[model samples]
Target chain A: MAKVLMKGNEAFGAAAIKAGCKYFFGYPITPQNEIPEYMSRELPKIGGCFLQAESEIAAINMVYGASGAGVRVMTSSSSPGIALKQEGISYIASCELPCVIINVSRGGPGLGGIQPSQSDYFQNTRGGGNGDYRTPVYAPANLQEVIDMTMDAFDVADQYRIPVIISADGMIGQMMEPIEFKERTGRSLPSKEWAATGTNEEREPNSINSLYIVHEDLEKHNWKLDAKHKLIEENEVQYEMYQMKDAEFVVVAYGTTSRIVKSAIMDMKKEGLNVGLIRPKTLWPYPYKAFDEIPKSTKGILTVEMSTGQMIDDVKIGNNGRFPIHFLGSPGGSVPSPEMIAEKIKNILGGEKK
Target chain B: MKTIFEKTKGLTAKPFHYCPGCTHGIIHRITMEAIEELGMLGKAVGVAPVGCAVFAYEYFNCDSYEAAHGRAPAVATGVKRVHPDSLVFTYQGDGDLAAIGTGEIVQAAHRGEKITTIFVNNAIYGMTGGQMAPTTLIGQKATTAPYGRDEAHAGKPILVSEMMATIPGSAYIERVAVNTPANIRKAKKAIKKAFEIQRDGKGFSMIEVLSTCPTNWGLTPEDSLKWLEENLMPYYKLGVYKTPEGGANNG
Candidate 1:
């Protein structure tokens, strides 16, 4: 219909429901509490189910149960809460269940701060729980992107039989922006024929399990999951290259950091410095190809983040020593200003190409 | 030829992985038989816990999920909410139910979730080779409790059924033992009643079936049965702690 002004957390719930999600289970955490609150209020109006679990562990397991029951389900949490959910997320991943997890970014190592931060890049992309697994992570910078990615996340989850994560910093979670609940179509999702719904005696009972006691059998299962990861890496890499026809250097960032990088690039351009930004949309299937597109005249890539530098490691992998890397970060929920980022770029320009 | 003791269709053809004389197999069989007798085999979704019964999903002839350690009750809540009309249950052990998963199970009961839980309390951790469990009796020797459980240090075993019954939302809570054929019959009756209560949407239902882990207990199958009757039955007791309004073991 028409665009409406909405908070980032509420838009998360609205997007899930718009994706035809019928169940939501979560525990309240700072910066993301509005998501579960929104679902608790709005879901019943649509004949959907919303439950507040005892803890994040229980909430993710509840998501597992609903996913196994062949329904569109989701849960949301902040940093520490997401850490508690890692075990259940791993179990859901191993069982090959489909569900959505929202991580409204906050600072962490323990119970850090409640402000905006992007410190969970490694935990989300490198399999937060355990084992050889990688979850598909989508980093959205703005509220509109949050709505679009949250809705598409479910379909992607079902198509691949994997849990998908939407990582947004506290800024996006708490910010208000005009968003249109667009009803996009043309997605081909596989039917959940393997779901653990009742058998009705028409076929073999479906069992969603992750324990493979046999040595060879466990290896086989790992290989099967590995094949899926490989396919995702090849087909699902999404990134954006902004204003880099013949730029001097590239700045790699995502989510809230990318937004700040855009401002820095604009500010730098006014001063005759052409700094470009490579924004990654999907974190796991990281767009290594984007690094290839960096200009030959570029000195290096500058990575900016809210944390000490979690995503910079990935930038290093994508760059593969092709250029020097610089980092400017403010941990514990502090965001580096656009001016600070521009100054860092100028400092890099002041030095010779490494 | 009349079928005197044919296997129930509620169970799959998979063989049991339980140790010889371990009562988990008996409990599994009777639980499935109860589901079959209730005509819910086609509409049941069971959550298997991560103890000795981790493979229970494979044996259940219905839609099933193997939940993470101690999270079966929460998982069952999810499944029951998704399919309100379907029969939902969790098969759990002492380590899986009483210890790590206490919060989930207690909250499930507190919320009056319409689901059944078959909690097997053997007082020891079998899969991990007989470590002390929260249900391990005081003065009971275990791998972790070499000199027997010290009440001064480890505390007494938790009475899960009694604790669950105290919750206002629980509709049915009972404790039973399967040490003898007569007790086996009674345990089956309690399990079936629990499922019936769940089918009627009568809130939370649970049956703590005092079981035997022969290998873990360092005893023969027969002696393990004796140990359950003499030690477990007396401490855990055998009776219904609560029931729905005007509800009973009607069968």
Candidate 2:
């Protein structure tokens, strides 16, 4: 109703509740612990339940359970913890259950540092667990975007009967900003007709399952999932094209790192250097069409990331060698300065001219 | 047609895929019958774990979830929380419950999650062939334990019912075997009582049934029953470990 200042992780929790999520199951992990903490404190007030699970694996399975029982459920975790959740996420995806998952990504190869990083690009966007299934991955860059997307995530999950992920870097979780919770008045979503809410013997039992012992049945199930993913890819791909009017160079990024890219773009504009940004709002069902928006005269494409380069692979696939793609990034938690990114753009632009 | 015997209402018309003499069918019957007898079949939600009972979703005639290995308790907790008045239970095997899923089960009990679990301690992993389970008794042979389970190497079999009974949240914990018809009758009673504790919202409840795995144990069905009585029951110890009535409701 009114603008309120809220931290990113806490806002994620508030957004889920606003989306009519009544159940939260999660284990504590850095940069994302506040989500579960906020949920635990606030959910009970609304007659909701916030359960701090024993482990990430158990937490995600609990989400699967609640989702199967035909309710809006959510879980959040950092990178290592998200790794443990892959199993349950895979199961949820396979079972075609609706739930929201939040990944406040931190540095990782092992139990890496808790500093903000986009190191989990593949883990969130790509098929993290075993399967031919995909979850809609949303990389919200700011607190307001976090709030907006987190609310819509629940709806989208139910609309398509799929898990939706909101991947924010550690910086986003720790940062605070002004936001408004706009109640969703989006497209109508289907009711959970296939849920495992007991039949009371009035109807045949509804089983929430992913097991298909027969190879042919499993194939049919997989193809059915593929069709759903295809529909999502067609109808739901989202991205923001910033200052592409006459840009000769485009930097592609998402989440927190894209903010730095924007600053770099602004700085380069003052210097009369043509620079623009294509920020992906959706990772899976990625904004491949955004590449077509880049002026054919563009000298080069620079992909910025907080990792060594995970999203770059997708960028490459999207660009399909249309223009020479360049990279500027740091691994672990170290972020590149705006000046550094502008300088890299200058270098790439200079090289492309020759 | 004079109805001398009809199938338990708890089960589905689909015949079980369990191996002959596996004894999983027995456990499934009693667990479902317990729910049916309690008039909970209408509200019952089941979670089937990964093991021989992985397809329990197919057998149990109720809303069911096929949980990942050892995560059944956690899943059941989710279902129970959503429908607190409904009956939620998990059917898990020794490998699923004691090995990979120990954290979920122990924490569920600690939190006093209002759910029931039917833990089948078959001493070996049957679905993937005869691998040694955490409940495989010391000196018991399995595919993985070619030379028999050495106590020094593999450690003693975990007594799940005893360990569960020690948890205060566990309103009912019992270990029973289905080796004999009288014992089978007792197992059914224990399972029913476990569900009753959940029905009363007393707290967490678990019934650990010592079942036979003939195909995996490489024993005849009859010998498997004898093996369960002579070896497994002695270590597992059939008795009521905990009850809501402080040992008064001796199931």
TM-score of 1: 0.98
Compose the digit string of candidate 1's lDDT tens values, residues B113-231. 99999999999999989999999998999999999999999988999988898899899999989999999999999999999999988899999999999998999999999998889
Model 1: lDDT of residue B126: 93
Share of true Cα-Cα contacts across chains kept by each model: 0.85, 0.85
Looking at model 1 chain A, which ten-residue stretch has the lowest summed lDDT?
A345-354
For each candidate, report its DockQ versus the true two-chain complex: 0.87, 0.88
lDDT values of the candidates? 0.91, 0.91
How far is B27's C-alpha from truth in model 1 (Å)? 0.9
- Candidate 1 backbone collisions, by pair: none
Docking class of 1: high
| Superposed Cα deviation of residue A186, candidate 2 (Å) | 2.2
Model 2 agreement with the true structure over A1-354: per-residue lDDT tens digits = 899999999999999998899999998888888999999999999998999898999899999999999999999999999999999999999999999999999998899898889989999988569989899999999999999899889988999999999889888999999999776678799988798889888989999999999999999999999999999999989899999988888999998899999999999999998788999999988998999888976888999999999999999988988988888878869888999999888876666442
